[model samples]
Target: MTTADLHTLTGAYALHALPEDERREFERHLGDCEACTQEVRELSATAARLGLAVAETPPRELRERVLREITTVRQEPPAHGRRGRTVTTGRTGRWSGYALAACIAAAAAFGGVAVWQNQVAQDARQEANQATRQNEQLAQVLSAPDAKTTSGELTGGARGTVVVSQDRNQAVFLASGMERPPSGKVYQLWFNDEGTMRSAGLMNPAASDDAVLLDGPVDRATGMGITVEPAGGSAEPTSDPVALMDFPTA
Candidate 1:
């Protein structure tokens, strides 16, 4: 093969689409060509990224169609040059129709990777923004002039404190020394207003230094309590509370 033909086979080499003999010849050429080596490395990394991006299984029909095309596709005879050796015309001719199909597939795969990367970045940004807003709201409630702070102990050697802001209708609960809940179970928070009890939020029992900023109707709450419940939490306290702290009223 000519130097130009070997250079053109870089993509095929990267994709493992080159014929055995041509692949060996290309490897020899790659040793002396820094540009081809770099190109092959870049193409390989792109292929890896594309593979990671494609998480879903391809449709059954796609495999069936490709197999059908392989059976029907015809191969033309290779052209002879002055030295009686075969000379491929272009990228399409250098490899078979399957190689052209692969090129198209690679283009589509890269496009998918771009879209997947954008979606991941967008999700991360949204999560960061949400965390920022939550922190700000928590800070506002904790720093409020009318906020009330109280502390107490629980049943399982756990200790908890709550700071409530009647002005902002929010509260912050901090707890420690709670053991991790059993599998399929979770700790759930509750707000009791007069005799009515309502779910405040779920808790992570594994947290040694847990801090949760509770929202919704905090101004009317008479007390806060936590209980063990199912994994997703429950509408009401399923069991006796591990901890309970009454809000001071004057």
Candidate 2:
């Protein structure tokens, strides 16, 4: 594989989803590349945390279907007697037993694959539902009768806007020409209440321009601010804000 292709395998490698040959190749690459190694480590940790999510029980109908299918599978009688001597009927009987075992192994493998696919489908559905809900909330704020919008300038000539609705108690932040943040740091939003600042959330570092719905209610917040903070963010601002948008007086 090309170097770029190998780099993209960090996630799959972290999840142990790579084929044996590809996994070995990636592991050898990992020994020399620091960035891929770090990424794989982080992805593995994130995967571990996500694994803690509660798994849903299979549907009753699915269980019943499996049970019914089980009844149709032929059972193999013991090949050995109580005296521990082989009790083979003939050469055909031994071959039949081998074929049955192979069928059973294949069925078991397919069953595992089915379960994994179902889990992946469930995770996708949950993520889609979450994104839908967020979009609905953003629409409410943007379409509110009392919503007001304001714009401001960020450092390095970038610009952003804040659209807030007192009735909805929500706000949406939109930015343009945003540069990538310095390594190990993130662009964080804050709810500027009077003189105090509360963390709204972190912006997508990779997005040059994006709309973000602020994380909390706009209650009594006179303005919004964006600051560069360490990754994962801080409880309080550690540096001057790159941009600040003051809400109009009510």
Candidate 3:
């Protein structure tokens, strides 16, 4: 499914309002789309805070219906499983709102506590999956051949560790232990490949020295450098490299 399709169904899925056909379809979409699943879970949490909400009277009987339906569909949180490994996505859902409304109106509803709880567990799982993916990505980028562990320093009144992965596919420069520019000055990263320079990003003197792993689209060249440039940085280096790191050929 397209990203737009997943976004369209996110609200329905999180609120547990999707019809049977839609639920099955979305599940298939989620299996392949990590980004969508994460988006849905975060939205679910926001919705949950309003579950026991008074901003609006729920449509009535939504809580019970959602519980009964999700009961058979969702698995309960494993009490014996790793602690905090799982979490309830959120308490508020499409059916949940409907159920809550009904409950408030003194209407009788199917009293299924077990099913209602399962939805909570599913939410927890969604959040766990997101965190796991980020951790894995961090490890992956760090393993790149160009990954460098430098004794952080600054030069020409500029400071930062230059990291250009072995393949020149990823890079990151974190700065610390340096003085700020004399107003209107900034630090920039540029990737020089085949005599062409592309601006990577700007530097903030306050940036920490942590091993900040940056996202991709880095220089395809074997060489990398940091320069003192404009606030937003330029495509080409206006000055010499205060710091330089290179990626080796595989």
Top lDDT hit = 2
The predicted structure with the larger lDDT, 1 or 2, is: 2
Instruction: Give the per-residue lDDT of model 1 (tens digit) for 1-250.
Output: 7765566555444444444466556666655665665565555445333322324446989845754444233223222221444433343334445655665588687777566446645543443344445545666766777978888887678778787888778887766566656655667888887767788876543334455666467857899888888755677788987777897553
What tens digits encode model 3's per-residue C-alpha lDDT throughout 43-157? 5545433321234324559744644454234323222222544332232322334555565454334655556556656754453444334334444555554566443445645
lDDT of 1 at 228: 87
Question: Which segments of model 2 are wrong by more than 4 Å?
Answer: 1-107
Candidate ranking (TM-score, best to worst): 2, 1, 3
Report the alpha-carbon TM-score of model 1 versus the true structure. Answer: 0.55
Order by lDDT, highest first: 2, 1, 3
TM-score for candidate 3, please give it: 0.37
Candidate 3 whole-model C-alpha lDDT, 0 to 1: 0.49
- lDDT winner between 2 and 3, please give it: 2
The predicted structure with the larger TM-score, 2 or 3, is 2
